[model samples]
Target: MKTPNHFKLTALAAIFSCFVLTACNGANSSTASSTADVILTIPVEAVLTRHGEISSSYRTTATLEARGEAEVISKATGIVQHILVEEGDAVSAGQLLAQLDNERQQYSLNKEKAELNRLASELTRTKEMHERKLISSDVFEKLQWQFDAMQASVNLAELALKETEVRAPISGVISRRYAKLGQLVNQYATQSLFHIVSNQQLEAVVHLPEQQLAQARIGQNALLEFAGMLPVNAELVRISPVVDAASGTVRAVLRVANEQQLLKPGMFAQVQLQFDVKADALLLPKRALMTTDNSPTVFVVNAENKVSRKPVSLGYQSDNTVEILSGLALGDKVVIAGQSALKDDALVNVVSVKQFE
Candidate 1:
């Protein structure tokens, strides 16, 4: 049938537009299929579980103190004339800590010296007289005795003079100063002149319950943890031979060598003692275990990359690992990371494997 050229042209243009639209729709469908065919995977990190040694640690609070300490005291009855050191001053054995006024001691020493000189001269004269028969033997012997007594007196006075200087009895840091300048100090006084403590090595003094005595022993390894400080190495040095009847506790002493002099006395620290290490124990990182339904559970991946929520029985827990008593076998792969985003039977792609070091 004859039709208008403008109408024919319009119909042709409409058909071409429809063909282009159909082609575009087909391409979109193919692209969507390609995307769907690609297997969606969740990247994750995993570890191959194995059996390792694990131990349970018991913690007790303690204080780090000097291994050796002494109370310095005055040796002579006199007033404190001078103090050579203050608190926190490091001192050595026999180092002068304070000095008493030496006026009286010096006078006594001088008097003894003059008497000894006179007696010595008298003895010399008496010996010459006795040898020449100018004096009796008895007189000469008396002069010799007098000279000996005077000499001994001089020795005593010299010793007393030395006692005027109060010296440290031990090498340590001065922790407390009890003597003040011009303070009357007695030789027989019970008051301590200075409190000195050794800082070269420290002790972790702990009083543990009697029950813990079974685990604590000499030479056992221990760790000392201080605030804002790294754990220090320590060992059990002493255990009290007897337990306190009132507290039912036994005293334990752990020694920590402060070779670098990093720790000071009276610092609070926690003592961690590990015991009963279970070798060949089925262990896993603590992060792998999660509380599921109020029970310890873990996500274990299978060969097909499918996860299974495993309810595990735990025995002991160490620093960052736990002992798996049941519900897992050796050579199983565990999801240590990305475990929170998984469900039972969920597919996963292990992006990386973590090695135990």
Candidate 2:
């Protein structure tokens, strides 16, 4: 028998309702899956916290200087007759550097020597005459006085002649040559014939903050950096007992050996005065620190790749690294890059990881 028309219409409506519900559920599932896949995950670079060495240090700039320097000057007045050494010549102490005109000096010396010889012969004759009772005692005494006076004059003449040769007062390399051949030089002139500097060792004076005076001590290690050169090692050789009132700093002297003569005077350098060091310290890269707040803060990544903002207490800080006193542990990954875009408990995708040795 055929079904009624109203029952057929009701069955069709029920089927239509079921189809609409199924389509809505399918759309909702697709959208939910897409949303989950698009969840924001920031890409960042991170480094694992590790135990390493950190040092408390003070940094300042200084100009290098030769520890030993000398200005060779003319001891006698004459014209420059010879130039034995030039700029950049290596010389030793007492080495002849130049020669001045000694014609006048030589003539004076010769005259004094001749007079000394004459006086010596006359004195010998007078002594023999006195011994033979032919000459009076007064004559012998007078002759002896003349001979002594002539001998003193001869000594002075010899010294004057010797001074004509300019000698290096110290062993060093000649940095400047002021006198040229045939140039007249005066003994009392303010000009220097040559400037010699010993580069076997170098020194630099740094003024550190007064607060660091106590920490600075003799025999402490220091590092010096110059532009376009590798760092050189130095030592704290001296410290000023008093602090400078005007600058509120203390003067400290650092000495470095330049056996190869690689370092020169007047070179500007960056100086690091290391006071204390911690051998095994929880170290973190300084780049990871975020100072937006009052205290230092860093974002640490957990095992699930989620970042959490942490406030860390600090200890000694060296170059590019800081000692993490608290709020961190060894092997904890800390976000170094892309931290600006991060918040607490944010999802992160560590693009790269760096390990500190």
Candidate 3:
């Protein structure tokens, strides 16, 4: 139906006005929805900051070793008569450990003593003759030399006889027993009789990179974690003065106390040498921090129940916790979980608050 031109223009204007009005209303509704969503709070788990001890540690692995060890060699040459101690036996210093064939030594010592007694009696007679001027000075001097030689032979025989009884050179656990009863042993250094080690104190032997040489120090506190065992306390006892050219690592040692005798030599352990510590520091769990950026960041929940993105400076960091040098304080709450969806000044609901022990 063809209508008048003015009427058609009026109808088109009316349609355009209606479309613009509907578009404006829809935009206003979308703005209101966005505002409502902005007010919505996110649920998260948080940890409260506290003043405690925090430390920076250098972590490395090492093998357990005995602080005092020795391989004892036989000192007597004869057939082994008896082995008093066996492997896994504890021994005290100077305690008899083994007995070689001492019968022959005893016989020789007795013969030498008899000869010494005979010489003593002859020397007395010779001295008496010399004093009476019946014997020449040369004869008296010969008798004196003979008597001295006999005395020295007897003394040597007694010493050799005593050596047949092998005594423990040090107090330690018998880790190895190479000597056997009725087996021929020699005084030569090549024949090892026993291996003794003082297991009461252990050592963690580790190699440190040259860069850490400056940080390694004697008497420094350390923590050791061994497999199948609880964590043990240790102290830095030694640091090598030279570097190994082949590995380019310096040798470092930590002493571990073993009053319970749990630590054994050759066991591998994880060592964390505490190089620096901050006492009475504001600390938080490392999970509370977002470290995947140029600067370390955290989401701190304020008293208003809003989350604020914070960039913080750190002091010392251990494996689990880190010291907050700035941008956080004691009693401040930090988001430890459900922080991926958080934003600055975002409303939040803390479902749980954990304390750092």
Candidate 4:
């Protein structure tokens, strides 16, 4: 059983080598087990599907215009004697705006009245004589005809005197005044005495693309945005039946109520014509949608922290949100971030949750 020193040393060395090898193998097995226990997961931001309101709209720009505008003109030729109203004055229909010199008209009226009275007295006398058979029938008839002619002349004279006063034809604000004191104005003059604009109701004129013709219906609600001011509500009152041949657009008119007189004509405004709206709908953040495969797609996270890729049918899409028609359910979590790196059945860790405002 005794061995040499050299052989003993060599055997001992071999045993030490085997022990080292066994230790290394055990360490390697422990590391492999730890690695197998670990599961890889992707971090992402998610939001829950919720019910909200959304609308589909067409956007355009237009200028505000007065719904009613008119140029005030004189109906009779005369010298402007009095300027009753100034620019920016509110006037009613048939309100006197100015007065003209009517001395000549008054004198003419007086002369006609005197002649009319004389003729009336003669006609009365003629009638009495005829009734008594003192005057011939032909003479009485002639006197009656003269009296009727005189009466018509007197009426004309009165109308001429009334025309000396200039009046407003419409109810509106006087935008301009052209007539001054002692200025001679006539009906045939091309210049208007005043410019009036009705501002109680305003109009917003916009041209929409021809493709939106079917959706552009009368009585649709529209929103008008102005710079440094609150948005105004308007209604679609008119839409041109024919599309413009040159621009391939349709002219649409939206009426805005300016009862407060806050808006004026020729102001630029941004217009949003809403054609469709969904009051209660399943809404999702538009950022969660992935459109790589033609149809809209979203990565939905299930209860097991696993994401399932889904194709969704979309409805009305508005700012920052879209209406989900199918392929998603309420309370389902959808990945808004890190969705690009995800696949079906991939494990995910929701880093943050966002709620739609």
Candidate 5:
């Protein structure tokens, strides 16, 4: 039987279509395989266990304030003549805070000064007269004694004059005021002239329970975090060596240096006392860690470009890293990213190994 030309043409077209489809499908498969075989650059870090110290910190609340503060008060009885400083004013040592009525005191001082001058001149003249035997020894001695009494009076008067001017015993800002203009202040007065606190240098006081008290000592390192303030570097300045029987807590004072005036008195503070130190322990970034069924695991990359799940023995954890006690060694490559999709013996490509600087 002879084949038709149109039939042969149609059959040829179908075969060509089949060949084209097969070639297209093969190309698609190749492209899919290439996409699946992804070469990823991952950041890695070497596991290093060095003989250094790691501290375990205990958190406690505290109050920030100057090491010392006090209220300025009049030491003598007087009527206020002038108010030298106001609230929020900064005063220095011996800086006049207020002035008292000194008219009477000034008059007394002047009288004492005149008597001292006259007595001193008489004493000089009497000594000269005695030396030359121009006067009796009793007369000269009496003149000398009178001169001593005048000198003592002058000294007392000068002290009274100084007391008229209220001065600051320390340098600080006046946070409050009680005495006003023309106010009568008495000696050993209980009223406060000005409340001054030294904020330039501050300290934080924390109360620690007896259980954690032993971990604290003088000069131990500490960290202070104040509410709405940055973390500050501090150290244990004083520890009540004995725990308070009433509260069952020990008092710890940490000195906080605030050259920038960042810390304020009565501000809430959180203190961390670091005690335990671990040496020769492997540590990893906290983000590089993952947990499985309560088992802490890390994705470690082997030399063959394969990732395997590893169980790590962790010791102490810090703000940024976790201390690993075992299951890791120095120079071991650990993956920090893409850990969620990692599996045992899964193919991987190390992007980078983060080096410690």
Candidate 6:
């Protein structure tokens, strides 16, 4: 239908405006609906359970030690002439450790020997005269006593001279050297020649609490550890009967054979005291448990195919596994990996157990 020009233009403009408004409203509503329908997809992994034995060992670090150790000191007063052995050298009982300048001691011994010879000759003549009735028995007895005294003096002098040559008292290895060549030494002076440590056997001394004393006994099997050697078998040799009043702990000694002589004495040692054993317990790898706020927890698969964190009570842990004291049931799948991105009710996909490994 043909109408006036101005009226037709106005009608066309109104129609275009209405169409633009309707299009704008429809676009806004579509955008809002799309935003509400948005869903996030996250990747996840599954959990599993396995059966294994968990060691109930109380883990502690210890040190190596020698069975018997001593400090070699000089007994006589003299100047050090020579030092034969050095540190880290093997020594045996009665082995020459060091030598002292024994010039004076040798002269004393020689003088005593000469004096004894003269006395012996005098006593012989006196004895002959007395037997022939030319001398009284009292005179012959006095000569005999003087000769015996001189003989004893000579023997003592020889012993003193021999002591100048220092000797080892026990079979061990020389661990230190203090006496040097030309150093003055005396009975009261500090003349530490060497430090000998018996390395054929090693002993571990540990202070255990009073409560653990009853559990410790003689001949009990123990494991010994050192710095560079593997764990070696040992036996409980002794335990102090009385507890230390100040420390309230008893000392325990474990004897270990040192076939390789790897252990040294005076080394601080730690000991693991196995007080009891658990016949059966649910154990899991220590890696499986995660801590949040000091409360130990583990992830388990829920029915909705999601991971849920469950708090667990723990007992003794050893090697790598920890005992599940409570809050876990048998056959429950535990998440060993993919824990970093996990959240409550998060979706999960079962990957191979190798992922945890």
Output the number of the TM-score-best candidate: 2
Q: Which ten residues in a row have the lowest lDDT in candidate 2?
A: 33-42
CA lDDT, candidate 1, residue 228 = 97
- Give per-residue CA lDDT, model 4, range 100-124, as digits (tens): 9999889999999999999988888
Q: List the residue pairs that clash in candidate 6.
A: 65-264, 66-264, 66-265
In candidate 3, what are the lDDT values of residues 5-60, reduced to their tens digit? 98989999999999999999999999999988766878999998889988767888
- Worst 10-residue lDDT window, candidate 3: 181-190
Tens digits of lDDT, candidate 6, 1-357: 766997989999999999999999999999987765442223444445444454444334556577778888888999999889999999999999899999999999999999999998888888889989999988888888888899999999999999899999899999888888888887896557888989999877777778766666677667665556576777778888889999998877778787786566665445554545565777766777889899999888766667789999998777666788897886677777677667777666656443221
Which regions of candidate 1 are displaced past 4 Å? 1-47, 50-53, 122-149, 188-191, 276-282, 287-299, 305-316, 324-330, 335-357
lDDT of each: 0.87, 0.92, 0.89, 0.91, 0.80, 0.77
lDDT of 5 by residue, 1-357 (tens): 557988999899999999999999999999888877763433344343333456777788888877768888877788988988888787888899899998888899999999999888888888998999999999988888888888899999989989888899898888888888878898875667888988788888888889987666778888887667678888888888788999999888888887787677888877788777676556677777899999999988888878889999988877777778888887677877778877888787666566441
Q: Rank order by lDDT, top first? A: 2, 4, 3, 1, 5, 6
Candidate 2 versus truth, CA RMSD in Å, comes to: 3.0
State each candidate's clash count: 0, 0, 0, 0, 2, 3
Please, what are the lDDT tens digits per residue for candidate 2 over residues 308-354? 99999999987788999999989989999999999998888999998
In candidate 2, list every pair of residues with a backbone clash: none
Per-model TM-score, in order, reads 0.70, 0.88, 0.84, 0.85, 0.68, 0.67
Ten-residue region with minimum lDDT total, candidate 4: 33-42
| lDDT score, candidate 4 | 0.91
TM-score of 2: 0.88
Q: Please give the lDDT score at residue 289 for candidate 3.
A: 85
**Over 4 Å off in model 6, which ranges?**
1-56, 61-63, 131-134, 224-229, 265-271, 275-283, 286-316, 322-350, 353-357
Instruction: Encode model 1's per-residue lDDT on 94-127: one tens digit a residue.
Output: 9999999989999999999998898888788888
